[model samples]
Target: MAHATSIQYEPVAEIGGGAYGTVYKARDTESGQFVALKSVRVQTDQNGLPISTVREVALLKRMEQFDHPNVVRLMDVCATTRSDQETKVTLVFEHVDQDLKTYLEKTPSPGLSPERIKDLMRQLLCGLAFLHSNRVMHRDLKPENILVTSQGQVKLADFGLAKIHSCHMALTPVVVTLWYRPPEVLLQSSYATPVDIWSTGCIFAEMFRRKPLFCGESEVDQLGKIFEVIGLPPEEEWPTDVTLSRTNFPPLMPRPIADFVPEINEQGAQLLMKMLTFDPLKRISALNALEHSYFQDEETLTQKKS
Candidate 1:
């Protein structure tokens, strides 16, 4: 911010277009390090940058001070004026070579080892807990949004992007996958931090299966797929405010988690079930998730250093 972005950073290549705008892989001319450039076009008023943008960026900066190993680093932020009405706000972030989605794909044969998966999950929950404790909710938690360093370190990305993308959400053509969505979100009920836990559960199972646990085409279908495994929530547990009635879903009995993820051990299955609980209020918190028996193995300490 002390200097113009152009003078310090050089665009290396076009990475991909995201919800708000195109992201580029850039090199810090001074540090010779790679960074991702995520920019959003904002409507400008007499007040300059939108209040929401300022607040989110400030939060990101504050988070950087913690130097949390699990969270991605926000390298820098700069604003460029495009016209009288529009301004471009670009966020620079440390570039990780791959994401969990691809990492799972590249696993040599069957899939990740149990110890390896536990290590990844521990790093992931540590990051999530850090963000949650700081009051940042990762409304969208999926493989692609989670970056994995070459050394196998996990760093959460795009944690609060939804809020900053609120104004342009409708205009964006990208449709977020509903596979990781929980019943509460699928039913269009109110949600909170517990939403991320559900996604984490899905990812946890995927680590063993090397594929998605519940592949759904629509919100209704997604709920049905989820119910097929976790079973339909009892009438009293269903959110009263949601238009999607509990009766719409078949009254199914809960299936064993082992049925879906046979590779997971018994303790991992229990923790996964806790995270995928139907009620957000009862769903396990990220901090508690870290302490689950599944992650209590002493091997985790050795792997954590790996």
Candidate 2:
């Protein structure tokens, strides 16, 4: 890997930061193009590169190889020696104008137009389908991780929590963000690609409602919130052999998607319900979702405009 000092780029501004490191908007000195630089703090001790960092870098590199437009492109990865002489890994990526969270905050009361929502959702599902087909689970699919360019193109970002899924391997249930976490994950049941679909459903609903569908303070509370909307699924709905955390949830009536998100049309509601299905096996896949009537209308509208 090249050292950050060898790279020709000037930091423009600090964009965001978390426990891992800070992200900045920078200009590539050679190409005169703007890019996002994410700096990850590394442990120089015997531990070496963090597993999270390793997984993220590997996944991003694989995505780069495929050059999927819906997924954020990882431009480069370089190591930088800080003033303390400790090495930090920096990831270079195509800069997006804003995240979906900020975009929604800036939109007016009624939220985005139906067409715009459909456009963004289509892009999200396309990216997710690409990831799922490759056997990768985003694990953390939230509004903050979905980037939007000035041209209205949506790209999936933040692979830090992502992992390659295999039937033989058991994954941690404590993966996705609280608001967007699926019922299976909360219930500590073995999950797979459908978890991403569940998060996508939460994000899809948030696009129309401008708020999270299930805002829970704790795991139990989150399950309660989900049950409040969709009702508790009977034991028969889940795999008979596997054990679940909250099997005794109060019997609640499932509310109609239209009643929950009145802004979305009937077709949109139908798709959302399928994505948010209690059973992961029954949840709609990203590719199947892309084929839904909701996006078909968007396709017709786009063709008309052109």
Candidate 3:
């Protein structure tokens, strides 16, 4: 049944009716602070919470203890059982009014400065690296879920929640875009943390172009779109387990990253290529990506400014 802590949050409005389950803006009566309440209804079925949901929640809670600057704060968690078969798991997160999607849309016609993009990518990678090091794969990463604070802090939200969302939705109605997905995932190959790095690379290019790099309509279409830029991998590079043949894509050579992300410099393009590499094994890890030469300019400029 519904309980006391649930009342502690006075609902202000429904923020999301889609992807992240039911999310609400609520006022914490005690602290007089605003927070986002994301509720997921999980099938209990005699066991308290499904093992998957329990594992995800544990991972989120563990990550919370680190108090990462670039990861959203998970403030509170409450479970209110509605029936023997169902339980509502409400997760309270510190609210941020803007997401990267909104931030990109609001950018002036000239678009974000290279320095601003660098700063955002740096923060994004830091958070991602933290999660990767902790053995957590974000599975889903895109502009909508990457929250941006008023002060321009980039906090990675919606990590470790895809499992919970899927548990509730069966198959979420939200049209999950293949735009940010890595090549392996599109091919139905096994994926790990590198999946997120590929998504970050897509987001990186999007920062420059102010629109998604690859907008594929389906898995095959998305792979074709990706290969159009990265080019089809060699026969040996293709995963043996996937049914999709490398011949499904053309024999075109890799295009210049600059062709798509024109504003990116030589260093940025090189790093982006490493990120978008076809082989998951060859993909750049978030920690290694942070050390890429592309970010050095920003570091040098920071040193000069200080």
Candidate 4:
């Protein structure tokens, strides 16, 4: 709610940039706290501000009311007039030390410990459960969208691709990044929260393997990679009315989870299996995932600590 001119902050460094805008790490003068300032390039049409920006701002505002720990908090929203008469919208967010991608890259050869991995996954699923309960679907949920703090806390970030889900409506299947996309979305079928679950599963695997589980080169190739590992879903498994682009997919045999990611324990593998199920209806919900046996030990430990 504060005006851009009212805040005094010195840019420390450019953290990241993309098609949307550049993010900078800045020190807030008033609060004396480090924050991330994401400067969005405003592309106004007859309708005024870009819909993506509008949606993101609105969603973040809504999320602020709940103050979920695993969800990134929007500190402020401000705008500045450019020399060219255009306005740049800067979204101030709580600063995070690094993204999951960078953290994984810096992780040692064997990757994070099982306990740490469980904690991260728990936080991710907790955040997702909160989002889904609020009827919001984070369409893009890759490692890059997951933020990590120095103290090992995980927060979900980047809501630009997110949208409020209505049960009666049919959303576009073009959501989510390629590797993390689910089969329903790839087939242009009507989808909902399960799409996010699929992405979460991808992130879950990456946490242990330090690489994407399904690294498909193209959409077709991506589907091939998925089938290569999980095998083609039988016709009975397909949604009754949904039709896929290719009915004659190669009958690749499904490999055991151990073959792809042996580092994870059997319980972790079981959770991954449910998350990666071909049928969206069969995929594990975030709330249910939190109750999975894989997290039982961690839950017990947390309880003991408390």
Show where candidate 3 strays beyond 4 Å. Answer: 169-174, 301-306
In angstroms, how far off is 203's CA in candidate 1? 0.4
Model 1 lDDT, full chain set: 0.90
What residue runs in model 1 are displaced by over 4 Å at the alpha carbon? 1-3, 299-306
| Better by lDDT, candidate 4 or 3 | 3
Please give, for residues 61-168, the per-residue lDDT of candidate 1 as tens digits.
898999999999998889898888988888999999899999999889978999899899999999999999988999889898899999999999988877888887
Q: Each candidate: how many clashes?
A: 0, 0, 0, 0
The C-alpha lDDT values of all candidates are 0.90, 0.80, 0.90, 0.80
lDDT of 3 by residue, 175-290 (tens): 77889999889989998999999999999999999999999999999998998898888999999998988877779789888899999988889999999998999999999999
Pairs in steric clash, model 1: none
Clashing pairs in 3: none
Model 2, 1-306: lDDT tens digits are 343434576889988753234678999988888898876555454566556556766866887899887899888888665535355777888888899999999999879998889889999999999988877788778898899888888899875433322211243233335899998887677889999999999999999889888899988899899999998787678555445444557888898888779899989999999999999999999999999998897678889999
lDDT tens digits by residue: candidate 4, 250-291: 877788988888898999999999999999999999999999
Deviation of model 2 at 290, angstroms:
0.8
In order of appearance, the predictions have TM-scores of 0.94, 0.83, 0.95, 0.83
- Candidate 2 shows a clash count of 0
